[model samples]
Target: MKASLRLQDTAIRYFLEVAQIGSISEASVRLNVAPSAISRQISSLEDILGAVLFERQPRGMKLSAAGEMLAAYARKNALESARVVAEIDALNGIEKGHINIACSEGFAMDFIPRTLSNFRQQHPGIHFNLKVCAPAEVATLISRGDADIGITLSLSPTKDIKVEYRQPSPIMAVFHPTHPLAHKKTVSLSQLQPYPIALPEENTTVRQLFDICCSRLNLLFEPILESNHMASLSRFTAFGGGIHLSGEISMRHQIATEELIAVPIRDRGMDVRNIEIQTLSGRTLPNIIKVFLAYLIVKMKHEETIGF
Candidate 1:
C-alpha cells in the first residue's frame, strides 16, 4: 500500500509557500521558481483538493476558508516531522534543534537573554533565534509560524494565537532609587508630573496606558524626550536623569541591581496590561520548546514571588 500524499511533493510545498507569502510573485522569488510554475502548482492543488484555496485579489492572494484549514494542517505536519527527526537524532546519541522566538524589546533587554543563557547551558546543541519586534508583531510572527514562541505586553487580544501563559503587567513608574518618588510604595499619575518624564512613543502600549490615564484625569504633560527603544529609556532613568514608564519585567534587571526602581502606579487604566506567552493556535510544539517553555514559566513565577 502507498500513502495518498507524499511529504516531498513540490506541489504542496509551492502551495504552502504561496499561502505564507500571499503572492505568487513573492513566493516565486523566495522559492527561486517562476511565477507561472507556482501558479500552476497552486491551481493543481486546488483541483486535487476540490476546493478553492485562495481568493484572487488585485494586489495579492488572500487565503480562503479552505486555504486556512490546509495551512493549519501543513504547519502541524511540518512540526511533527521535525519532532520525529529530533527524536531519531536523540536515539542515536545526538541532540540538536533550532527554536525561534519573537518578543518585545522589553523582554529582550534582560530577562530573555538570561533565560536563554541558562537554557543553553543545559542543552548546548539546541540553538535559538530571537527577534525583537513590536508587541503586535510578536503575535503576527507566532501566527505565521515564523516564531516558536512570543513574549509581549499586549494592549488588546489577538485572534489565531494561543496564550500559553499570562500575568498582569502594569505600567509602573521607573526611576532611580535616589529619586524622590522611589521611596513611595505606590505612586499615582498626578504625582509623576513634577519630575522630568521620558516616555516611549505614543504608539507603544506603555505610552497608550499612560496617555489614557492622563486623559481621564485631565492632566497634561510634555515629556523631556520620547523614544521607541525601552532600553534607552530605562538607561536614562537608571542614571537619575528622569522618570520613565515601563513594566517591572522590562526593568527587572535594573531593579534587581538597584540601578533603577519600579513603583506601581495607583491607577486602574495604567494597570490594564498583561505579559503573554503566545504560540500558533492548534499547533503542537516540539519537545525542546516545551521544555524551554516550562523553564520560562518557572523563572517568571520565581521572579514574581521576589517582588521587585
Candidate 2:
C-alpha cells in the first residue's frame, strides 16, 4: 500500500512512539534516542505528509485527526519491515528470530513444548514466547497482532483470522492408571457417574463438553474439585483419587509415562471438535515463523492421523 510511503521508517517510528506514549520524553527513553531527535523526525513527518500528527499540550501530546489514520499504516508497515528483516536473515542461512504465541492452556501443557523443542533442534537460534489463553481468545490475539500464531481447541473462524490447520481434539476422561475404570480403553457418560471427579471450570471447552454429554445421557454432574488450571487437574489425577476430564493432548506426557491414563468419553460424536492453528489473515509471515508453523501443522496432522 502507499500508506508507508509518506515518511521514512524512522519518522514513522518516532511518530508512533509519541502517539503511543503521549509524550516525546517517554518515547525517547524507550527508544534509547534523544528527545530532540525524535521531535525532529516527527516534524519532518508532518511536513512531508502536510498533516499535523499531534496536538501539544501542557500535560502531554495527543493524536490529531490525521494521526489516527497514520497509526494503522505505521504499525502495518513496521510489522512488514520486521518480516523483511527475517527474510533477509534467512538468505544468509540464518534461522534466528523470536516468535510470540498465544494459545489454549491445553496445548501449553505438552504439544507446544515438544514442538518447540523439535523445531529448535533445526534452528537453535529461533526463540519462542508462549502464553496460555482461552480458545475463544486465540483469534483475537492473532488478529490484534499480539501473537504470531495461535493453537487452540474449538477455535471459531473469523474474517480477520486464518486457520492454518485444524484436527479432531476431543475431551477425554483422565485419571490414574490404578483407578477402577483405567483398564477400560474408553468410558461413557454413565460410567463416570459413580466416581469422585475433578473437572475443569465450566467456562473451559472441556467442561462444556462434559456438561453437555452428561445432560444428554440424563446423568447428574458433580465435581469434588473444579479449577481452570490443567496442571492442577493433572496433579490431582496423578494421585490416587478422582478422575479429571480434559483433552487427551494436555496430559499426553503423563499418559505416556503411566503417571496417568486417558480414556475417550464414549459417544457416536459427543465430543467432536477441532484443534485449530491460526494466524492473522492476509499478513505475510516471516520466514522463520513460517518454517516453524509448517512443522507444527504437519506434526499436528500426524497426531490426528496416528494419535501422536
Candidate 3:
C-alpha cells in the first residue's frame, strides 16, 4: 500500500546516495539530510558489511570493487521496489504510469505527437518522456534501458533490440503546393534532376541512400541548399525554395494543410524506408508501454491503410 520499502532502510539509502553522487556533501544535499548523518550511515553500512565501498580521492570518492557489487545490488533493489509500487497502483485501479520513448527526429514532429495525443486522451494520468536522436541511436536507448519503446527507420538485424512491427515507409519527393512537379500524381527521382534540390548532409543515412540510389540510376544530385535536419528541408520546401526528399511522416501536417506536397519517389533503391517499432529483446514490457504500443500500432496501420 505504501510507495514500496526497498530503499527506506536508512543506511542502505545513504550508501546508495553516496555511491550515486560520489561525495558525502552532495549526497547529503540530494537526500535533504545532514552531511554528518550521511557519513555516519555510510560508515555504519561499511562496518556491518565489512567492505570498503569507496576509495577516498582528492577529486571525489570512487567506487571500489566491493562498491560496484553493492551498487548493482542497490540498482536491482530499486527496480524491485518500483515493481512493487506499480503492482500496488494497479491493484487499486490507478492508471498512472510513466513511459520513456526514443525515436528518430521525424517521429518527434508528427508521428509521436499524434500518438501521444491519442494515448494521453484515454489515460490522462499517465506521463510520457520523449528523446529524439538519430535512427541509429534508437536501438542503443532501448538496449541500455534508457527507453521503453523505440520508433525509427528500419534497423534490421539489431544488436539487442527486437522489432515488433515493421511496415513499408517509402521516401517521397516534397515540394511547395505550386511547384511544377506538384501537379503530377507521382514524381520520380529523375524528374527533379534539372532543378536545384535540397538534400540532407553527405554523412547522413538518408543522404547516403540518396547517393547510392543516384549512382545506381546514373542520376546526379546537386543540392543548392543542403541541411542535416529534416525539419529545415521541410521548411525550405514549404517556402518554395526547392524540392526535397525525405520520409513522409515529418511532413504529414504540412501536407494536410497544403503547405507542402509529398509525391511518391519511384526509385527502387531509396524507396524502402520501413517504419519499425522496437523494444529491448527478451524484456517484459510494462502495462502502460503495452497499451501505448497498441495505440501506436493502430495508428500506424491506419496511416498505412488510408495514407494518413
Candidate 4:
C-alpha cells in the first residue's frame, strides 16, 4: 500500500510539472530528476488512468484532452492545499502569505508596482511573486494555479479565468508633449502616418486592433521600431521622435510627470480592449488574496477617475 501510494504521488507530481512546463526534459530539469525517470512516471500515470495525456509534437509536448482535465484537477488540489496551509498559519496568529500575480508588461510598468508597495505598507509580512508576460500567458498562469491573481488586457473572455474586476482600457496615442499631434485632443491614424512610429509587437492586442483598423482603410504604416517590452517602447517615445500606442492607465505616471501625453485615438475598435483582474474559476481564495484583490480594484478605479 505504501509503495502504491508513493508511486501515485510521484506520478501526479511529475505529470503536473510536465504539464506546466510542456516538456519532459524541461520538467526533469525543474524537478531535479532524470528525464527518463520523469518519462517513466508519466507513462505509469497514463497506464493507470488508461488515457493519453500528452501529444508528442516536434516543437514540444501539448496536453491532450485527458491531460487538460487532469491538469485542472491538479490545479484545484494544489489551491486547496495552499488554503489549508494558510488556515493553519492564521490559527497560529501569523500574518504571512505569498501572493503570486501574473500580468502583462503594461501593468508591470507603474500601476502594479505602486499598488504592491502601498499594499505591503499594511501587510508587511505578506510577500509577492510577480510574473510579467503577454496578456494570454497571464490567463494561462492563473488557470494552472501557478498564479493567485491575473491582471491583463483581454480581447475576449478566457476559458477558465474568472474576472473579479474589469474596466475599459482603450489604446491611445502615447508621445512626448512636443510632438506635432500632442496639441490635439484626439488624433487619427492617417494624421499620424507621416511620422515615424514605435509599436508593440504583432502579438499584442493593441497591435491587433491597429492592424484591423488599418486593414479596413487599406492604410499601410511601417513602424521604425517594434518591441514587446513596454518600458523600452516608452523610453524610445520619451526620446522625442516617434509615438507609441498604449492604454492611458499604463502610462498614467509618465503623463502625470509631464514626460508624455496620451491622446484618444479617433479610430473604431481601439476601445474594444479591457483590463481584467482575474483568478481561477470556482476556487476559494485565501484571505490575503481577497484583501489584496479588493485593494487593487479600488486603486484602479480611483486612478481611472483622477486626471493627468
* Candidate with the greatest TM-score versus the true structure: 4
The stretch of ten residues in a row with the least summed lDDT in candidate 2 is: 1-10
In model 2, pairs of residues that clash are none
lDDT of 1 by residue, 1-308 (tens): 12236333688789889888899999999999999998888887787777899999999999999889887777767777877887787788887889999999999998999999998999999899999998889998887778999999886789888888888888889878889999899999899998899999866799888888899999999999899988899888877789999988888777888888888899888888898998888887777888888999888888878874
Collision pairs in model 3: none
lDDT of 4 by residue, 189-249 (tens): 9988999999999879999999999999788998999998888999999998699999987
Q: 1-308 in candidate 2: lDDT tens per residue? A: 35346568788778887887899999999999999999999988888778898999999999898987787566666678889998998899876899999999989998899899998888899989998887888776675566899998872466577888877777788878888898897888788889999888866788777777677777896789888888998898787768888878888788788898888887755567788888877788998888889999988888777774
Per-candidate TM equals 0.91, 0.77, 0.74, 0.93
| Alpha-carbon runs more than 4 Å astray in model 4 | 1-7, 56-60
Candidate 2: which stretches are off by over 4 Å?
1-75
Could you tell me the TM-score of candidate 1?
Answer: 0.91
Per-residue lDDT of 95-148 in model 3, one digit per residue for the tens?
998888999888898989888988888999989899998888888777655688
**What is the full ranking by lDDT, best candidate first?**
4, 1, 2, 3
lDDT of 3: 0.80
Superior by lDDT: candidate 3 or candidate 4: 4
